[model samples]
Target: GAGVSQTPSNKVTEKGKYVELRCDPISGHTALYWYRQSLGQGPEFLIYFQGTGAADDSGLPNDRFFAVRPEGSVSTLKIQRTERGDSAVYLCASSLIGHRGELFFGEGSRLTVL
Candidate 1:
């Protein structure tokens, strides 16, 4: 029963570069979600996937952000043309299903755009 995990717990990047963050969800969990949390703020939903298709991606900020969950397991968030405003903690969570279930979050990938 591996819990969700994220890599590069901290990342520092330039304002216009691209970066990719990885997440590994728990086994047997079919619902995966990505969220962003700025300092002193609650997590804001970014995207979610059920199986291989993105069930909800309404929270993605703009075209600069995108994510994919292939094989219904591991997921990755990709950011293009990063900006200082994009600096935040990107969190990944997963649950058995999308509903009122509780979401287990990873330590998060902290992105700092300079």
Candidate 2:
């Protein structure tokens, strides 16, 4: 019954800390996604999952970022050695199908790196 959900509504960290962002998608939805939004920009596609596997992960900027959807219902985004440039609103979304269905999006986790 729940829509997409994300944890740690806000986080502030030093530049070198590691962070893990979590998302819980709507039950039975097979498409889950992670996106990032910086300041005034629209959310940028980071990665997407169809069922239990990552279908697209090309949007990740570099090796510091990774995501997983092991059971097709929940996913996590991991960032290593975070930088001030990494500060942004990390959003999660889900749909019934891959990239074509109505997307249900989460409120997003705001990360601030100092």
Candidate 3:
């Protein structure tokens, strides 16, 4: 089966603009997660969804950041009023079930807010 996939590998946007990053998980994966990685830092958790419902969303910095996994296979991370500080690589990962299983991550969508 295919691994996770993210679209628009790179994105350049001006401050205050909005952007959407998409991720497609592997077949049969029920656990999906979103993470963000800034320069010189490890990827930080953003959101996690079990099936079609988000189970955890505490990592979202603010209301401006949101995500959805309506079909349990694909997810979209939406950013509103983006700022220069928001520039980073958004990563998506998927797993079969609980944390005990292996997590496969996408190459990541790099967003650069100028």
What TM-score does each of the candidates earn?
A: 0.97, 0.96, 0.97
Task: Compose the digit string of candidate 3's lDDT tens values, residues 1-114.
Answer: 489999989999999999999999999999999999998999899999999999999999999999999988899999999999999999999999846788899999999999
Q: lDDT of all predictions, in order shown?
A: 0.94, 0.92, 0.94
In terms of TM-score, how similar is model 3 to the real structure?
0.97
Q: Once model 1 is optimally superposed onto the true structure by TM-score, how far is the C-alpha of residue 12 displaced, in angstroms?
A: 0.4
CA lDDT of 64 in candidate 3?
97
- Please estimate how well model 2 matches the true structure, expressed as its whole-model Cα lDDT: 0.92
| lDDT for 63 (candidate 1) | 94
For each candidate, C-alpha RMSD in Å? 0.8, 0.8, 0.9
lDDT of 2 by residue, 23-102 (tens): 99899999998999998999999999999888899999999999988877889999999999999999999998878888
- Per-residue lDDT tens digits for candidate 1, residues 3-112, read 88899899999999999999999988899999999999999999999988999899999999999998999999999999999999999999986756989999999999
Looking at model 2, report the run of 10 residues with the lowest lDDT sum. 1-10
List pairs with backbone clashes in candidate 3. none
